[model samples]
Target: GDSTTPDAIRTRTLTEETARVFRSRVVNPRWIAGMRKHGYKGAFELAATVDYLFGFDATAGVVPDWMYATLAETYVLDKENQDFLKHANPWALHAMVEKLSEAADRGLWSEPDPELMDQLQQVYLDVEGDLEDRVS
Candidate 1:
């Protein structure tokens, strides 16, 4: 952080780095497509990553509301992506949506769009219902 020249001082903190990586990887279409190629395990990784994200935010207070929205819009809500998760691993689908719902409920997504959150709630219920059908 400290540097001889004022201009040379490092500017990015762990918060920025975390957000950057999340945008480049998690919300990147190419990365999502790549994950789709890996099938069940790929979906599992995505779901698990959300858990890690939530945990990190719980401790660091760095995750922005937009990041959660991106995860929902780009990953969970997109039809192709949702279908991929469904066929590859419905459990992962359920797990991921559950985490998102928890995040919103906990105020991580403090000012989420009403329409978007409404859709997410419906998706969560549908995913849970899908799981219920399989086990029953």
Candidate 2:
């Protein structure tokens, strides 16, 4: 008999499992809301997690492009989360946006949505101006 088992259907590919975890837990609305409840510390953790995702994908060839795209959409580009970070910790927001953009620029998210990139660039500019103003 072959080594393949009937339960092979339950075995998800690396990408599929990664996507499942990311959507169900990492980017879930409830999880995001819960993180936000912790104040600035929560915001910092969110940004740090993004960096970790980026790093793992950079080193290992497992993460799919859509994961990055969806994460950017659900976390950084969402207006509600954007507003929260802008007020609670603009620097974290800025870093998140910058990392996403870097991911795109490096082709980690090859063929990223043009419109989303445009929106992110605009947000980056606005956030940069605000930070500069605060310094001035």
Candidate 3:
């Protein structure tokens, strides 16, 4: 008997879950070690690394509001992260934008930092535009 749900949806759900499990069990430990070796500091760096490894899905609802809030706060306060943000990978910038936008849309953060959101949006737009130009 066929289920009412679509096959694509089911497959995507299963794949995402499997990936999450794999990240937790296998990738995270090794990634942590590497980050430590590279002298990465603070929870924001760790969270960014997780987002990079897992790949951000705006529709997946994987990133929590608390994480977004923490990221926003860190972005403003951490001098090191401030410099790193300028050179962040395109994918990482996109992930940060998606997560922060999601949090803002849901009114998850009590007071969303407009400056932080604007900075991330600018980076995301610039990176995406650059990619598009490269493709074109």
Clashing pairs in 3: none
Clash pairs (backbone) in predicted model 2: none
Worst 10-residue lDDT window for candidate 3 reads: 35-44
lDDT head-to-head 1 vs 2, winner: 1
Order the candidates by TM-score, highest first: 1, 2, 3
The candidates, ranked best first by lDDT, are 1, 2, 3
Better of 1 and 2 by TM-score: 1
The TM-scores, one per candidate, come to 0.88, 0.85, 0.42
Question: Which residue window of length 10 is worst by lDDT in model 2?
Answer: 1-10
Which segments of model 1 are wrong by more than 4 Å?
Answer: 1-11
lDDT of 3 at 40: 33
Runs of candidate 3 with Cα error greater than 4 angstroms are 1-33, 36-67, 73-89
- Per-residue CA lDDT of model 1 for 1-136, tens digit only, reads 4366887876678688788789888788899889999999999988988898899888887889999898888778999999999899988988888888888899887888889988988888898888899899
Q: Is candidate 2 or candidate 3 better by lDDT?
A: 2
